[model samples]
Target: MHAEGADAADDARAALLAATGAATLDDAVIIARGRPRLDGGEPAGPVWKVRSTRGLDQEVSRLAKSRGVSKSQILREAAAAYVEAS
Candidate 1:
């Protein structure tokens, strides 16, 4: 490989390692319970994508299962609670 090619390869390796450190997908979930990281896009939040699935997983699913309410009910309750608290 040319000198430029070698440098590009090194840069790519470093980027991959950075991405790995940024997000680790295990058991279909991205763990983001710590400090936020700003990357090439919008600021990363506590929202962890369900990598094992094709679409987003609503938090209400787990909240509902745990709280004995439907997903919609959980969302409504959460919105109300947030509005009241704020």
Candidate 2:
């Protein structure tokens, strides 16, 4: 079992090195450690939850689809613009 785990780790490290063009195992490890958590371990940044009408949600979704971006991206851009204009 330990050998299997080690092999999996080795495979992941090799794949990471290849994908990132890292020259060393240390570099690959650093890159892996730098990735943000997506499993609810810890957030990479501030997260906000807002309440909106269904119409607003649909509009945001429509805008996101038309702009070829995620709904979150649309909301983030809108927030940034509001801040800049303030």
Candidate 3:
């Protein structure tokens, strides 16, 4: 009876792994966030969050749309520009 229970538990575990698309416990544990890199390079560094007014948020969105880039890209370029100006 003990051996039968162990086999049933093993079967349940295999079914769970199949359902979650993870082959092992380690594969099921990892959590990755953010956009994946297209260059096959390392992921981006730490994230920076900023609070913005509604007007400023709209302006940044407009600028980003005009330049065909993401708001994050715009922010990065703006930071570089500030460093250069300083």
Candidate 4:
């Protein structure tokens, strides 16, 4: 590779190493949970994606099934509860 290409590859490797200090996905989640809010300030609008693992998805599905509610309803209620609490 060219000298600039080599340097870019090294930088990318260093960034990935820094990002994955924890060895497991669960550890990464814990690290992520500890991070400060990334919004910089209050968000400008309401629409956003909420991320979760398969484990959480299964639990939410179970709750929805038992409660006779749709998955959307469960997710919406969860988001509403979080918004109200914060």
Q: Measured by TM-score, how close is model 3 to the native structure?
A: 0.51
Q: Write the per-residue lDDT of candidate 4 for residues 1-86, one digit (tens) a residue.
A: 99999999778656554564544445544544553433576554465578889999999988765554456667877878999999
Clash totals, every prediction? 0, 0, 0, 0
* Local distance difference test, candidate 1: 0.50
Clashing pairs in 2: none
lDDT of 4 at 48: 59
Q: After superposition, how far is residue 7 of candidate 2 from its true place, in Å?
A: 36
Q: Can you write out model 3's per-residue Cα lDDT over 1-86, one digit (the tens) per residue?
A: 59999999889777655654455744433311233463488766778999999998889988765554467877888888999999
Q: After superposition, how far is residue 4 of candidate 1 from its true place, in Å?
A: 78
Tell me the spans in candidate 1 whose CA falls farther than 4 Å from its real position: 1-58
Order the candidates by TM-score, highest first.
3, 2, 4, 1
Q: Name the candidate, 3 or 4, with the larger lDDT value.
A: 3
Q: Report the Cα lDDT for residue 47, model 1.
A: 43
Best candidate (score: TM-score):
3
Q: List candidate 3 segments past 4 Å from native.
A: 1-40
lDDT of 2: 0.74
lDDT of 1 by residue, 15-53 (tens): 654644432233112322322244556765354333423
Q: What lDDT score is found at residue 1 in candidate 1? A: 100
Error of 4 at 22 (Å): 42
Question: Could you arrange the candidates by lDDT from highest to lowest?
Answer: 2, 3, 4, 1
Question: Model 4 residue 5 lDDT?
Answer: 100
- The lDDT leader among the candidates is 2
